[model samples]
Target: MAGSTDVAKVYERFISLVREVHWLNRISDLLSWDQQVMMPPKGVSARSEQYAVLSGLAHDRLAGNEMADLLAHLEAHSDELDEDQRVNVREVRRSHDRARKVPRELIQEIVTTEGLSQKHWLEAKQKDDFSIFAPWLEKMVALKRRVADAIGYEKTPYDPLLDEFEPHTTSEEVAGVLEGLKPALVELVRRIESSSIRPRREILERSFPIAKQEEFGAWIVRLMGFDFEAGRIDRSPHPFCSGANGDVRITTRYKEDYIPASLFGLMHETGHGLYDQGLDPKHEGTPRGFTVSLGVHESQSRLWENLVGRSMHFWRFAFPFLQAF
Candidate 1:
């Protein structure tokens, strides 16, 4: 058996390898981000190939026998670790186990298919044609089903996929929550429709230049505590936040005749950027350093965009700026 010092050394080695894998994953994310926001139209095929290669590399690193051994050792001696170290080990182990269950070829295929699907999706959306995207959507669904089966599940195939993002959640649990909320949501909508008060929708239709919108968005996000030095804002066809921690990037679209679209979209993406920027740097490249779940992440965006950004107090405070524009 290894001594305490020897065990610590092994753990540190394992952490180094994990960090390397995470760096590769981050690079892959950056490539996809560039493909979405900056890559030229002719670069789709090359981008898909690049994504597939990177996905395979990351999956191999995560699913290798070396990782399996390290995780087994860590699990056997988990009592020796600090709470945070134990949590990291557990999360890493979960990821490793899931990755090991899925073949590398399958992982690569999913990445390639997703890239192609996204391209077709954008084209279909632009053309307002569902048929053009139907085949890709069908392919993606079949691939996801295979992935779920490979990962294994107790109740439903969707359980594995839901767990992938939310960790320890199930489709049944989600359905239950949605079922409970349905009546309340319906009542709220009905009440709003029956209310005498009506918003002046045309107020937001006034001309707003893209440059001024960008400047205003920057100001709002800065106030919301998004670090411009550590992050950036760009324009994309659809608004999104990408990257993690020290290098977060967010994008929003602009419409010359629709002020609220860009303004609210920036606020939404900024919320996501703030969460990414706020993660502990020491925990970078680890599960603890990442957003907790997609649902939780969406909550942050909705909080900023709806709860705060749409509040009367916020607009009242910014009324001067709104008038200036």
Candidate 2:
């Protein structure tokens, strides 16, 4: 049996390893954000190599024997640790076990392929050609299937793949929920389509300048509690929120002719940014500090984007400024 001091030392060692892996993942996220937002068109090839190397290094650290031994020891004496330590160990073990089954080479290949595929996707979209991106998309799909097989799923390959984002969840469970919602959603759409009421399109189609749109959106999110000191809002081909520690990046696209596109899009990403910024800073590198699940994250975004951003009361205060801009 390990003494209390010995257990504490082991836990510290485990945390140190966890921190290294966390930092590598965060750095990869930063690079990804740069790739989408700022990287020159010529940098994709080199960036792909960088992503592969980083993915390999991070995978090795998490799935290595040292991490495995630490987890084994801590898990054996889980009673000796507090709630937080135990939770961290359990989550790390879950990831470590899954990662160990997947070859490091496969992980690197997936990362490299992802970078190239994204680049090709953007090009294909710009040129309005699907053929240019189809081959890379196929490669990406095959690689993911390989990963799902490596991880070993019970029902479907998608179960393991979906678990990557929403831990402890299964594709069947997701399908069930979606199926349940589909009926009500279909009914709602049918009602809207058949309704006699028609919205005033001129209000939504009004010419809102892009610069003013940006200004108004920023102002609204600031009031919604997105800390600018720790975050940024930029334009990307698709909207997303990438957050780690104090740095959170939010991106959205602007359509000058469509007022709601950027405004509501920014609101949505800002909702996600707020949730990321609200996480406990002390647990920034550990599972305890991480989000509960993607479902929770999406709830935050949808709550703000639809429940609040679309509310008449919210616009009551916001419309005058919007008109001024």
Candidate 3:
């Protein structure tokens, strides 16, 4: 009984430390979210520095010797934990190992570069000129290549980078999936193009007041099970979902003349918002509380965007509300 109690105590302590790391990451995410959705254009430099410093601090904590010892102890006594505890320890250890491989300075550099690159991307997009962003994009790619090398890959440099967002996945596996899918997708597109049946496309292109669209988008996402009390929607140049459990946020851009742009975008981002808001609060600030991977995350958004939002059944139900607008 005493041995079991000691193990439990050790597990709790490890979890507490993991929670600290989670909080730091959450703060970093909020800073990024603000940079995209709310920060002033002139605030870019200061925000970039803040992002880099927070990123470095988080990396230091995750890769520190204290975390190393705790993870090693938890791994050695993993059998003593329940399934959830065991999984948390396993994931934290994996993250620790990966973080330890890359230098803190490199992590800071990557974060800073990402902030600057995004600013450049926004400018390039506004001007509709790739040349304006080419240099920054090239620099980011090189930095990422360095990151991939630092992390070490068995087959290709891309594998390590892909693994960051999609654990246990390899570039080759993704390529195989895409290769298998391409033929079917191409055939489906061809069939659609050749079909005699056609639907009116003019309705979707009709003018929609931005304010009304915002109201309609809010209503639609509510129907999709997005908790407004725990989440909010805003506008950005591009649509994205951010934040974690209990504070999820989504943003979408509205075109005054295009109804589908903000409407469908809201649906898509709401799908991601639902996933974030639905996470187990008890496991908040832990790996188990997070979505598994970007692919899985994207699946939720696409499912809502395509399988539900774009479906005939949904349009049948939505047409009335849309007409009222």
lDDT of 1 by residue, 66-94 (tens): 88888888888888888888888888898
The candidates, ranked best first by TM-score, are: 2, 3, 1
* Candidate 3 residue runs with Cα over 4 Å from true position: 196-199
Per-candidate Cα lDDT values, in order, are 0.88, 0.91, 0.88
State the weakest 10-residue window (summed lDDT) of model 2: 1-10
CA displacement after TM-score superposition, residue 56 of candidate 3 (Å): 1.0
lDDT of 3 by residue, 1-325 (tens): 7867877888888888788888888888888889899898888889889988888888877899988887887778777888999889889888999999998988888888888788889999999999989999888889888888888989999998998899999999999999999999999999999999897888888888999999999989999999989989999889999888889989999998997899889999998998899899989988888778998999999999999998999999998997797
> How many clashing residue pairs, candidate 2?
0
Give the better candidate number (2 or 3) by TM-score. Answer: 2
Q: Indicate which candidate wins on TM-score.
A: 2
Clashing pairs in 3: none
Candidate 1 Cα lDDT to native: 0.88
Instruction: Judging by lDDT, tell me the better candidate of 2 and 3.
Output: 2
Q: Per-candidate TM vs. native?
A: 0.96, 0.97, 0.96
lDDT of 3 at 276: 92
Clash totals, every prediction: 0, 0, 0
